[model samples]
Target: MSSTPSTVLDRFLRYVQIDTQSDPNSTAQPSTEKQKDLSRLLVTELFEMGVLDAHLDEHGYVYATLPANTTKYNVPVICFCSHVDTSPDCSGAGVKPIVHTKWDGSDIVLPDDLSQVLRQSEHPDLTAQIGNDIVTASGATLLGADNKAGVAEIMDAVYFLINNPDIKHGTIKILFTPDEEIGRGTAKVDLEKLGAAFGYTIDGESVGTLEDETFSADAVKITISGVSTHPGFAKGKLENALKIAADVLATLPKDTLSPETTEDMEGFIHPTNIEGILEKVTLGFIIRDFTVAGLHEKETYLKRILENVLTNYPHSTAHFEVIEQYRNMKEVLDQHPQVSDYALEAIRRSGLTAKRRSIRGGTDGSRLSFMGLPCPNIFAGEHAFHSKLEWVSVQDMQKAVEVIVNLCQIWEEKA
Candidate 1:
């Protein structure tokens, strides 16, 4: 009953067919009730596999345990985790997965939309997937591979371990979280009950990547207030707040401080939303940097721009607010080097050259690391995530499952 490539592919395709897009504006724990759709299904499958404790909690998280089959009590408890919710940036409803069996190194034109093409040059990983089975959506919606691929790989790995009891391993924990795409994946996690010494998030891009660092994140809000007056008498008395807000946006550095302009450790001050009227305007921004000092610097620069813009409009005033989101996971991961080292070793045992990388965005692992569970991210073969062109190779997904299995064995052997 070992999991073959077909098992992983089948699970991913089925999971994506269900809509589980999380909501960022929702204040609820799960953000969207539909996320529980996949959560319930995962619990049912886990229970059928003999993991009787598998159940969805009040917060819509699915937690289960795979008891250690080994006599080594000293082996540390390890958890394999992934999120069930997909990103809200794109539509995840009614996904139709298209499988390209035995890719022939040609550009993949999505069926639903010919304009949405997966170019081999844009996706260098496709070079290695030439002969592998690649899965994608129909171009009308995102493939949900960002984390669903991770969910399937984790489930298949559990199935393999349970079916092959001869494989010695430590007590393994399985966690499927909701609202991760909204940045609240572990908000209600009961770490005391989980009791795992360490964990790994199967929520990264590419097959050979093991990410230990993530960008330190912050949220910023700027509000502008302007005088309201009749248009007929507005010659010298009225100052439009909407115009002031536009000025601030226009003043933001185009080449140095934007998501489109920054890359590879360079931080950015990105304006995510702007809404305003003639009298009042609000601007929402997300700030990201690899270091705390860098985050602060970007915030300071942003405020300076707002101040300078308001200087011209004497009657108008502005307010700037900064909210702490999450910090770099490396701050905590550095304290426990073995957590990442074991994963790199496991990747090698799975017959792939390990590549240590840092993500430009944050993950559930980033939040968990600061929440007392030192967790790093492992690759799940996702590429071009949060887009209609997103895709993943079945062969790479199987390799990720192998890494999870090897990681379990390495923990027991080292113990």
Candidate 2:
């Protein structure tokens, strides 16, 4: 391949430099107001690309439209969506994107932090990028390629469609959402305003991967109340809430049923937060599985763990509450098979073998699918996302751009 990079690479480099990390603890729709910075910029770029209706709303979502170019068939409107916000798991500020041109198969040591090294052994996808340009953060911060790469790819695809009007296509909608990392990507999304019959979130990892199945998710909050007493007078009378919470956690299976122990298709009970005093403590957990049955099974198992732990402390009481997060999109996607079939054909047209797989986590598409959009996830070439070791390849992004273009054309042709 030539050393020349595509416009998608430039767009990705430009977008990642802007810090848009979403805060999980915030109550705002976007969770972080700074996320709108990227949303606004995306709108500006979309307007510059001749997308007249491109605008950012108060909810930190950038919506735009590429009018239909084909008059032959009544093609259903489709959308290309991506999140602008990065994860709070790592610093997204001052992201110095280092593009290693024609990278050899070697470990990449990020300059800012010498200990932050990217090895092919750790990142299996690097083997395919033997001579391709690889992008990484300058240590101490994430690359923001998680969905910024998707954002740039969608931007370029829209730009391409506008420039090459001869490549006939139906009306295509563009959406740039915020706070996806904190699970609020579609919190304020106005689907009626978007008006897309189908959608694709270009936010998956690997070059040729397309994901339609996502984890059915639920959030569990456990509040433990314990008898608090004076330390000097405390004996058997003291039932510390912190100790009760610790006991429950300690009782969880050490070799299984955890994020650290789980692998492909395996669901896990992940403890996200734990906070409290000796009198009361709140433990937060997230349960994930492919099926709704499996999802509930995990939740039941968890409640059982809590019950067993509380039996030892007769004075202590616990409350377990389960909040529905999102369900497996595959349920809705299965009913609209054409959406994924068209995507697979498009991926094949992009000169790559389609690698269809299930996502271990959820995406905005998960909620959108049940919301009547039948959206699936497409690859954006992002890998090891939400961490300093995150990376993307220039060649892979260009291929993603091609896939987007082909997918739109496929929709037009099929219509």
Highest lDDT: give the candidate number: 1
Estimated TM-score for each candidate: 0.96, 0.95
Residue 365 in model 2: shift from native, Å?
Answer: 0.8
Model 1 per-residue lDDT tens digits across residues 182-255: 78999999988888999999999988999999999999999899988999989888999999999999998777
The RMSD (Cα, Å) of candidate 1 is 1.8
Query: Residue 99: error of model 1 in Å?
Result: 1.9
Candidate 2 segments whose C-alpha is farther than 4 A from its true place? 1-5, 231-236
Deviation in Å, model 1, residue 388 alpha carbon: 1.7
Q: Which stretches in model 1 have alpha-carbon errors above 4 Å?
A: 1-6
